[model samples]
Target: MGKAQKNKTVGRAEMSGVERLGLRVSAMINSPRAQDRCAALIHRMEADQDADWEEVMSRIAETDGVSMVFQDDGGVLLEWEAPTDEDRVLELGEVEALEVEEAPF
Candidate 1:
């Protein structure tokens, strides 16, 4: 289970029109058969409706290990990962939401 933190700057009551974001991630290793084990995390942020997943992913990918952030609403933001240095704090410092490429699955 993951712990939820409150952002005093963005009061809970103020989270009215903000849209939720979903983040997907996969580790990249310098190796042969470098298969990226992709996974995703979801965050509910009262952000501008115009914010797109690609834009959010590009912003978050600036850091190491930051995979991606997608918009998952209506409880689609399930599944959480163990906390790490990046996730230690409430805010998703660099990465926020899930990033996944369109592959023929």
Candidate 2:
């Protein structure tokens, strides 16, 4: 018999300003409402153009399902509910496509 596994109920992460910006961009690109706006911003950011970080952070914080807090040291604390078992299963399937390519065939 296998031991029971404990479920994680919440998740937390601390990120630097740049990392938080990337996370916000990822979330926006996945959102139906924000996708169109974020696509242009992504291109500008990637091209080292004038994409303001503060403005980006403010916009993302206003989006639905996003909760953002800025730290005094300019870092970010992100918190969210842990994925349920059903969500975990779907994510695991996606992870299978992300296998590392370091091994020589």
Candidate 3:
């Protein structure tokens, strides 16, 4: 992946006992939910004063398929398996938007 961007550190030891060594995670992060989740991670790093970094890694490691990529410039990149059937339903063969109700002031 472009020499891993030169300064990125592949998270090999982010989780001691977690086996995410060679998991193949998609480099694409174009999905809305995926992007939102990554943004939340960044926001957490910025706003959560008492955030547990390792705990966060561990929680992610606990997921079925996951990986971590840390950039040299304090940027955190997450790699996770696409949503499971139980986690999300993607076959939108037929979908209809519901009307929203306005709130009373």
- The prediction achieving the highest lDDT against the true structure is 2
Q: How accurate is candidate 1 locally (lDDT)?
A: 0.40
User: Which has the greatest TM-score?
Assistant: 3
- Greater-lDDT candidate between 1 and 3: 3
Off by over 4 Å in 1: 1-12, 16-19, 22-38, 41-48, 52-55, 67-105
TM-score of each: 0.23, 0.31, 0.35
| Deviating ranges (above 4 Å) for candidate 3 | 1-51, 84-105
- Model 2 stretches with alpha carbons more than 4 Å out: 1-51, 86-105
**Ten consecutive residues with minimal summed lDDT in candidate 2?**
1-10
Report the poorest 10 consecutive residues by lDDT, candidate 3.
17-26
Estimate every model's Cα lDDT from 0 to 1. 0.40, 0.53, 0.48
Instruction: Sort the candidates on TM-score, descending order.
Output: 3, 2, 1
* Clashes found in each candidate (C-alpha, N, C closer than 3 A): 15, 0, 0
**Model 2 steric clash total:** 0
